[model samples]
Target: MIDPDLPLDEQNARLRAILGALMDRAERGQLPSRPMGQLSDVVALEQQVRARTRDLAEALDKLRVTNARLSQAERDAVGARNTLADALEAMGEGFAMFDARDRLTLWNSQFCAALPDIRDQLGTGLPFQDYVRMVSESAAIDLSGPAERDAWAAQRLQSHRRRNVNFVVPLVQDNWLQVSEQRMNSGGTAVIQTDVTAMVRTERLEREKLLDEQAQMVRATLDHIDQAVLIFDAKARLAGWNRRLREIFAPPSALLASGTPFTQLLNDLMRRRLLGRGNIRQVLTDWVNGPASRPPLGLDLVQEDGTELHLSAQAMPDRGFVISFTDLTRERRAIAEMHRMNETLEARVQARTVELEAARDAAERANASKSRFVASASHDLLQPLNAAKLFLASLAAMDNAPAQSRLIGRVQSAFASVEDILAALLDLSKFDIGAARARVDTVPLGPLFARLRDEFQPMADRRGLQLRVMPCAASVRSDPVYLKRILQNLVSNALRYTERGRVLLGARRHGSALRLEVWDTGPGIPPDKQTEIFREFTRLNPSGEAGMGLGLAIVEQACALLGHGLDLRSEPGRGTVFSVTLPQASAGPHAAPPLPDSDQTAGLLSDMLVLVIENDATSRRAIMGMLEDWGASPIEAASLTEAEVQIADLGLAPDVILADHQLDDGATGLQAIAALRAAHGDIPALLVTADHGPALAEQAERAGVLVMTKPLALRRLRRVLQQVPQLRAGQGNSAPGARRGDHSYWLRAGD
Candidate 1:
């Protein structure tokens, strides 16, 4: 140890040997307090301290490695927990969990959100019973009274106790929810509530559709039956009928309905001279009520015109009588023809049959070709016009230079003129093809006039003309949609022709009819010209006029279809008056009530939720954009199924539905709206269609939907939207819809 020059390895070995020997001596109590012994002891202690420090350091190094591994495991565990929470939050269905103690332990935001009214009372540590009580007291929808709330809750609680059970609950809002409860491994329950309203509505609609198909099948069977079938109730009221009966009797529509008294029907038949030779009163009464008074009866009667009819009656279980009428006129004629045929040649019969078949085939082919050509041409002509209108509307909505804005206005006017011409051509084609038909209903003149006023006001303002619609108290039996169109064309023609004088629209009673008149103080038409004015494309002054003169033609055709009398009076250099005489109808449930006078300028379309089911992307976008400009929330869907998904996903009900008649997938907008209303409450619906005939309007009316024809008039659209009860002022787009380009509709009901 004293020799510094010794080899390093040899020195370290000597030091280790000395330390070991010293430690052994120390262990044997050999180390003394002497300086030399103390120095050796200190040295030995140092060696021992160094060796122990190394061991401690090795242990510390292992502990550090273990700590790092533990930290990573903790991070992974935290990440997993956060991931689970995010997944729960992202679920569309409401999710919640409760521990064995029946206390809420976890829940996604929708868990409480779905409850609506009692969400404030739900949270962790909330007892299941307390939550149930809160729900019973504050639920937005319930079918049971408060008295039964406790009982219902008790039953519900009992159901919850069952492990892994699932059930369904219905909300009074017409919403159905599926509640699934899963037993968690930790003695807890996981609940998932999914909205099944759409599913339930689809099922119900399917069933209703099936029933409708079955009814149609029955109607078709009855229509095809050879014998004319009629049924009268025990009270002798007319009930059942078929096409053959209608053809055989040619009874007036009112006389052949479900509730006409048998006596009245018989009287009408007698008045028409259709009854056969019999004791006038007693015999006919016996024929109608004999099935009830007696077992059954059969009668053969010969009409004054030499037609024979066979009637057989049988009593139904419901005390009604089923009567069958077989026309024996054919049989008698067949007998006569048989006698005559014996003297005829077979060659003549064959020649006549071939000639008739050839004529019929030629006529059918010509009609079919004409119809196809007209339909295709109309669609092609209107498609570009519709697209142009949409783009112009969009451009008009943007902030533009004044001259540019004026240019857009002119373009819009041009588009309107083009559309009108196309529409007129289409209408003419429909009328010629017999594709246009009338559906008679009770139409209130007051409301119809008010709508007319709203529509014509803007046009009148543009021309500095006063268009006034006089008060009306009458309701008429007519097709309101077509009638409105007819009047629109009439009033529009009057406005266009009359330069300065006010256009007056009013109705007057004439016997049992209402004579709706449109008076104009413009240059009077000559008697010679007035007669030809109704002809298509005939105009008195064609110079600087954009009108194609098809308005009067449409009016003439519509009047003919509706059986309305058209009267025109004109004085040279004075004025002209045109009137349509319509049969006045009694005020009934079918009458469309007058619209309330609301400020059209006030936030009419503000804050309204409009679900538009339009297949045309451009039209849909245009409508959405326009509604957005008006501050209405518009939710667009291409089909009913898609609309349903959007409605469900948005989790909000629509106030009104605006749809196009022809949707994709062969589904009508009416069907989509029907499905939505079946799931939700009755929502006001307006159907827009390019189909201009009365057939489309009638179909819409039959489905209880209002028609808004396309190329939609902005003023008319505004007026119709004003009438929708769903629109309310000061509402905002606060749902998921706002981001999806849904705007709001504001309502100004008063002032």
Candidate 2:
């Protein structure tokens, strides 16, 4: 069992030492080795030595195998523990373990990471509650309650069994961490912390965003709407309102104040209530709920400041009611205007209806008057003609006697007056029936004045008054005969009215107009009676006048016919001047030149020819005689056809033609003149009518023809004839001779 290859010195030393010890013992051992008995003792000792060596070797081998098995078991246990620690450190949750004394026994890396501030205390095994108290106190987290401490301890103790805990702890970043606990057999507590910061932050942000959007939506919707909107709390306190409500109820000062009481605001509103009819409370309630269950309430509100508003209200249960007010002042004004317009229309309609009825009544009266006039005229004609016949027969019976001649002259004169009246009446009828026409021609004023001078000179001499014709170079487009008639009537009236005064007939140009003036230094017309003088049948001086009051009326009518206006200026004792305005002719040398004698007979006619057309035998004869006396040849025709024939057959080409408007064949002289002028050239023509109608005169003037009423004075006839150059001067190489005649010689037959 022992190695036998030992060194000899070592073996020898060992034997010697043993022997020496044996001898020392056998002083006690030497005597026994030399005998048979000495052999037995040596073998026994050797065997004991071998046995001891073998037992020592066997003990060493067993001790070496036991030590190897114990080392292998310790290494396997260390590897398993390292794997468990790596698993705990990989978790997101903070993990820690504490002992039954609440001291930290074991803690993973995550626990130290989660609470870095307490990492130095981990190995010290501090109580879990103390660690929580330290975190609460130092980090500003609250963890003071017993329940919280117990809960934390329990969470640590049961950390492995639970996924999360009921209570969470918040960190400085506003992040939340869920905690769980478990208890270990080692009387330690385990804690797990899980981060839930993102979930909690998202939830909170969502709530805030929703509130902000809601507030913005409410503000935008209320502010832009036309109606007023109010929001109130459950206590009926005002919380918010739109701009419309603020404008209606709150002044700028009050709205800007910090905090105004709802009750006080309501009281102020009631004091300034726009509706006066209802109590404030009742009105507010009605506005909130409407009049009927579903019907709206409409009211016209008049504020204390006199502002009118139309209001409509709608209610919301929790949000209060919205009231809309619209100013209606302009609408009320429009309504008033409409009312006035309606009243005006009604008044106009009533006035028009009344005027129509009045016009109808006037027409009926006029018809009655016409019938009466016809009957009276028929009766009057019978008496005058019968008396004339009787006188004529008696004169015939007394022929050859000198007394018979005088009787015949008186009879003739009486019959002539009657005939003139009848003729005037007939002419008036023709004018009324619109049968009158005009023959228009150019009329010179120079010659017209000359003839007037010759005729009125004698009359003026007899009356011891000066009669003058002022110089003028003016011609007009008008009816020459009618213009002469108008002048004759005016001059005659002047002579009749004045006892002794000079009468001057002159014309002056006013701009493009000519004013024919007849001025007399005699008794003037009363201002109040001047207008009446131009009316038919109106007279200012009636005594010693033996004709109807129609002279001035005819003059006025003639002025109107010629498109001329008449103006009168007078004073009671001074004199009267009557002016007739006519359009002036274009200025030229050939247009009615002024006469050579500027002072004496300045407006006299030097050379002119005239043709006289008359229907009545006596009138034609008288006109021809007057024209001849004025040194003017006069061609006569009884009818328009006869005049036309005479004008054509004579080939005389007279400067002026005078014709009776009412011819024998019911043909107007205007038709005859038109026919003659068409065949020849435009010649001056005059129409003689007994018509006194204003409309007839106007028609004659409109046709450029002159109209003269019946019973014409010879002087006026001569003046009109002299106004025509071609008529006064015969159609010859030389001018005709001028003849001087007494004004009385040219006097009308009746005069």
Candidate 3:
């Protein structure tokens, strides 16, 4: 009666319902006896029922097939589970399951491999905690203490539940295993372990190497960095410090051992102003919040042991400040020494500057005094010379007298002395102004020698000394004027110094130079005084003669200007030799002609009319007498006015005109000569001046007149007169008596 299409639960309910209905019908006596026709129908119905039963059996067969399929699925699932178990057992990661009691339930091959010594006990099912203790006690691993082990175990348990624990442990075997644990269920735990010994060893070595490298880098940085480094913890306790810090603060061995309080250390520094004007905590706080609020702290602190330290510190709010202490004793000492040395150097420089300033000031004052002296002396000396010249001119105009010659001679001598002094002073002034330059020219030595002989011959003869000039064939390029002066000074000096014996002037060739020498065989210069002789105002024998002692000084100066070398050789009581070396002239076979003898007397008593215009009557007479004696007609004029009157009124144009340079009317002889020449065209004139001024000579030369300086010599006058071209034969000496009776008689009568 059950529905064959229904599910098992529904079919069971339907079968139950159909059985109850059949029993009830049986109980109800609804039976039918087998009737002959009806019996056949009933049997048919039963057959139908049997057919339904067979259909039901076929349905049960389908259900049996489904059940068999389900059984096969279960078997496959079991096999897969076994395969998983095998796989996990063979894996490098140790797989295990454990109960809540921490008992090892299962372990993989990798776990046994990791702990080979404990491989045989794998199935023993030991507690994980017991295993940890055994390993720790055996020294195979260090878990520190029970507390540490408990912490680790608890962490492992928690990590297992979360499936996050993956850690390794080294065992007796030369490998390590990664142990990962997970809680499988409420009753047990699962663990997976892998052999990661190579990785672990490599990682450990890398870690160690990294640590070592970091240490080395730290040491290198500390050794090379300019700033010192120190580290402290939040407790203000020293944690780490570099070698430089150790050297600065304390010895390496004792640094950590010393339990020195940071506050006490800071107090020492603060007392010394190392931490500025604040407590250590306040300084540290300021540094942390804002370092700009306070000034930098630098201090020198002396320790109890007498060690000095320079301390500097900076704060790191969270961590303690890094304090750097540097030993600065040596540096301080060196700085002190440097400061002292600088002071000494500055003092020396100041002293030297003061000395140099003083020296410069002194030099300036001396120069100023010298200039004043020269100006004053020159003015005073020139005024007297002008007056003497004027008086001499007036005397020369007088009539002739018996004592006139003697009077004129005395005046002449006096004038010579004044002239010499003036000349020397002028030469000295030229040197002072740096105008005493030399004009180098090729001078015929012969003529120079001749002139020197002519000038100094009579002088030497009067002194009873032989004056000779040695013959020289050389022509030298030198300043003729300077050479003449030098030689004159040497000769005059020789004559003055010498009592007897001859004086020789000579020249010789040495190498490419000409050596002009003056030798005197008389009392010589002492060897000690030879060097002094060339100095200005240095006279070896001042008592011997009247001299300014500038002669040899002038020689030296002239020689220097000419670029010549001067040498002096002398032996006391023997002789003195003064030599000047000059550059040689061009070499050649040709030489200059010999100079004419100055002593040769030529053309006496020529037809020469000599006009003598002189302001000094004495000079005019002397000159007239000398000209008449030489057989020449002479005319005399006392002044330019007289000369003009004589020329205009007398209508007398003389062949030669001679004029005195200094006139009574403040007129120069140059003016007198100009007036005379205006009357007589192109007439020869001679300028005679008692003035030793070079200006007078220059003026006369510019006027084309010959110049003769006073104390005029008669010989020089004769020589000058002979140069005149207008004198006719037998006209030179017209009448000595007529000449003497005229100007000479007046000159004598006036005297």
Q: Residue 505 lDDT in model 3?
A: 95
Query: Which has the greatest TM-score?
Result: 1
Q: Residues 509-598, candidate 2: write the lDDT tens digits.
A: 778788899998877889899898877646554323234556777677666656788999999888899999887764323333323332
Q: Model 1 off-target regions past 4 Å? A: 1-372, 380-384, 450-469, 498-503, 521-523, 586-605, 665-671, 674-686, 693-704, 719-751
Model 2 error, position 163 (Å): 99
lDDT of 1 at 158: 87
How high is the CA lDDT of each candidate model? Answer: 0.72, 0.59, 0.62
Question: Among all windows of ten consecutive residues in candidate 2, which has the lowest summed lDDT?
Answer: 740-749
Model 2 clash count equals 34
Model 1 poorest ten-residue lDDT run? 735-744
TM-score of each: 0.45, 0.33, 0.40
For model 2, the local distance difference test gives: 0.59
Model 3 lDDT tens row, 1-751? 4556676656555555555555465556465553444545445545655565666678889999999999999999999988887998666466777777878775556664545556665664788766554444443443456776566566654555564455765455455556666655586777776767688567447535643553554455455443456666556666566666544544436444334555555455456553334354574545534442222345566655555666665444344555666766666765675566557766577766676579678776765555445534544444434334434443453332336556755665665665676566556666655646565656657767877887799878877999999977577888667788899999889887777899999999889888999998877887778888888767665323436678988888888888989999998889999999998886233332432232474464365777777666645665676666566887778887777776776676877777766678688877777866676766666676544444555556556666665545455456545545422232332311111111111111001
C-alpha positional error of residue 194 in candidate 3 after TM-score superposition, expressed in Å: 99
